[model samples]
Target: MAKKKVILFIVEGPTDETSLSTVLNRIFSSSTVKFQVVHGDILTRDFTSTSKIITAVWDLVKGFMGNIYHKNDICRIVHLTDTDGVFVPDKAIIEDKTIRNNAHPYYTETQIRTPKPDSIRERNRRKRNNMGKLQSCRHIAGIPYSMYYFSLNLEHVLHGKTNLSDWDKVHCAEAFDLKYGDDPNGFIIFMQKSSFSVCNDYCASWDFIKVGLNSLNRFSNFGIELPAVSQTR
Candidate 1:
């Protein structure tokens, strides 16, 4: 009876699109929410030296909306990117020590951060500088944008079940189990049945995602309306 929200999921690849769509659809059903996937380009760059996120995201947004236009109909734009090289292990550790650090995979730094730890003042300074450089893409034509980043890459988010040989494709949305990957419907069922909340393994991003989804109209129109909203950060 209520109107559905139009959400544009700007994902880096189809595999992401597949899993996310499947999960969200199970939660919101096919009627109360409509999802449109707009594929984005991953910039070719020496990522260790510089972050090309702004350039890549800008291309995706501008390509869709063009130079000047109002986007009131769109409920929210959720941009997803992976933290692939965020905390690469020291080469010598993997080579000589042969014992890699697990903290690298559990990297919690989402905002601009120094390569190594810094004093509070220094950290703030670098953060400000990075923010200023990124302001152009951060605020885009007044269109609401929220970002979701996967730590250590999407495969790691899949609990290292990255290989295609590990999973089965579900019937509806090509869903794959984020953890096991052997059962394609596992994730979708979990999302649909439970009051889904933040997962520690997801690298502290679930609440941010809730805020983005809340920006939409009637976001709680159907099943599992805004679960774990109270547990949001």
Candidate 2:
């Protein structure tokens, strides 16, 4: 028998990594496909600036690119990131389409790790401007690894809730355990009662996952596939 291909996944954090892993496992339950989840860094204020994010992602993929371009065994790659400051409707710094469209193979990779303006104001200005261009979503250069960003935040996307206070997220986790018993689909349902943003988020994720899943199922690779974006709401 031929060896199963390995699918690589990059996510912002462990919890989201775990969530995405579970969903993928459920989707590919019948296969012996293997998955690796790399802890991706979020480029928001907490993770430094856009330059750092770009450098970090470039470093990860440059290694993979060496192999992916030459090898036939590596199947695909999926990148997941929370729109920490991007999709905050009330305070969004990045546009939705900008994030979604960042993934494509045609764009040139820019060198942004160089020093920025000396003035803090200028540094921030440049950071904000450059972030809009890439959000450092450079994986589009990757042949099959699609760059995907979450709406608002991860918990909100996963739980289907929004404007969530830290306290609310903790409470929702408890409710998730009590009510859904760790069923990801059930957790998606929980996202429904959330804000409008979250509803949109669920739909966005459903679409991405559905496409990737179809590819998986067609080739016998993934899916316990979720419902259509419309019905999911």
lDDT of each: 0.39, 0.41
Per-candidate clashes, comma-separated = 0, 2
Clashes of 1: 0
On residues 1-233, what C-alpha lDDT tens digit does candidate 2 reach at each position? 76666555565544554445554444333433333335434343343565565555545555554654333554555555443331111111222333232321111111111112122223334434434545324344353544554543465455655445547766665554554443546544444443322234423543432331121111110111233324331
Candidate 1 residue-wise lDDT, 1-233, digit = tens: 55555556666565665666645554444232333334432432223112645655555665655543336545556555543332222221122122143222212223222233333223223333333343335354465565544433344354333222224323222535344244324543443343322333332333333232221111111122233433221
Worst 10 contiguous positions by lDDT, candidate 2: 105-114
Q: Which number leads on TM-score?
A: 1
Error of 1 at 196 (Å): 14
Q: Candidate 2: where is the Cα deviation over 4 Å?
A: 28-58, 61-71, 87-142, 160-233
lDDT of 1: 0.39
TM-score of each: 0.46, 0.45
